[model samples]
Target: MKHIWPIAVMALALAACEAPPSQEDAPFEPQYLGIETRLLEGDLVNFHVEMRGARKTRDIEDYARCAAAQYALIRGYGFAQHVRTQVEQREGLWMADAAYLISDALPKGVTNIDAEVTVAACRETNIPTV
Candidate 1:
C-alpha cells in the first residue's frame, strides 16, 4: 500500500507540472493585451497607456513585462517621459497605468486635446519610442 501511494503521488506531480504549450505555438485570441490610451496634446502630449484585463494567474512578471514593453514603445516614439501609472485587478483582470510626456516639438495649440490612438499608430506616428 505504501509503494502504491508513492507511485500515485509521482504521477500527480508530473501531471501538475505539464502545462500546455503557449499561445505562440498555438494561435488563440489573447485574453489580455487590450490597451487604453488617452492622449493630451498641447506643448507636451501626455499619453496614458494601460493594460485592460482580469487577473487569472498571479503572474506579476507578466504584468511587469507588459508595462516594460509599453513603456519602451511609447518612449521610442516622441512621447514624454512618464507622468503616472495605476494598476488594479478586478474580478479576473489586470490593469496598468502609464503616462508619457512630449517635452517639445508640439504644434501651436492652447487647448489640450486628449487624443486616443492605437498602439500601432503610436509607434508609426513618429512619437519617438524612447
Candidate 2:
C-alpha cells in the first residue's frame, strides 16, 4: 500500500515534468500579403515580403525566396544565390527583407537556387511567386 502510493506520486511527478507541446506543433495557417521586388544593382535584387500567421521567421524567408526565384526566371536568369534575409514581426504581421543575386549560370555558392526548381516547389507548396 505504501509502496503503491510512492510509485503513484513518482509517476505524477514525472508527468508534470513532461514538456508541453511546442509552437511548431500548431497547424500552420500562413496568410501571404504581398511581395515587392527591387533592383539593387546589376544582377542583384531585393525582395520585401509581408504575411500573417507565419509559424516562424523561416516562413517569411521562404516567401521572399519564392519571389526572388520567380523574378530571376522572369529576368532570364536560371539561378539565384541567397545573400541575406532579415525578418520581423509586428502586430501579427510578419515581414522579410531578402537579397539574392540572379545569374545566367549557377552561382558559386552552396545557397544557390535553380529558379525553375524553386518556382516549381513554391507552386507545389501553394506559395505565391512574383
Candidate 3:
C-alpha cells in the first residue's frame, strides 16, 4: 500500500509537468513563419517568408520587409530597395514572396532606406529578422 501511494504520486507529478504543444507543433492559424533567401544576382536577393497566428495582410508584409532589411545588414549593407513582393495565404499560412536589392549606399534614384532602422522596428514588434 505504501509503495502504491508513492507510485501514484509520482505518476501525477509527471503528468502535471507535461507541457502542451507549442505553436510550431501545429499547422493551423497564423504563427510567425521564418524567411528563406536566395541570392539572384549581385546585391539582389529573393525572400520567401511565411507567417502563422496572425491573419492580417499588412503584418505579414512587414515581416517580409523586416527580413529583407536584416538580410541587407548581414551582407554589410546599410540599405535595401524593395523590388517586389507577392503575398498569399495557403493552408492557413501567410506567405510573402519578396525581392530586394541590397546596397551599401542607396541605389541610384532610390528613396531613403535604412537597414538599422528597419531591424530596430522589427525587434520592437517581436518580428524575427536575419
In model 1, the runs with Cα more than 4 Å from the true position are 1-28, 31-77, 105-130
User: How many backbone clashes are present in model 2?
Assistant: 0
lDDT of each candidate versus the true structure: 0.42, 0.94, 0.84
In candidate 1, what residue range of length 10 has the lowest lDDT sum?
A: 111-120
**By TM-score, how accurate is candidate 3?**
0.72
Per-residue lDDT tens digits for candidate 2, residues 16-64, read 9999987689888889999999999999999999999888888898999
TM-score of each: 0.34, 0.86, 0.72
Off by over 4 Å in 2: none
Off by over 4 Å in 3: 1-30, 109-112
lDDT of 3 at 57: 74
Candidate 3 lDDT at 47 equals 93
Q: Pick the candidate with the highest lDDT.
A: 2
Rank all candidate structures by their lDDT, best first, as comma-separated numbers.
2, 3, 1
TM-score (C-alpha) between model 1 and the true structure: 0.34
Q: Is candidate 2 or candidate 3 better by TM-score?
A: 2
RMSD of candidate 1 to the truth, in angstroms, is 10.1
lDDT of model 1 at residue 65?
31
lDDT by residue for model 1 (1-130), tens: 7799999999999999998876346542325454444555643233322233322332322343333335444445422343455556675455555454543333244521122233344355322221
Cα RMSD for candidates in order: 10.1, 1.8, 10.2
lDDT per residue for candidate 3 within 9-115, as digits (tens), equals 99999999999977557653446768899999898899999887754677788888899999999889999988888999877778889898899987875543689
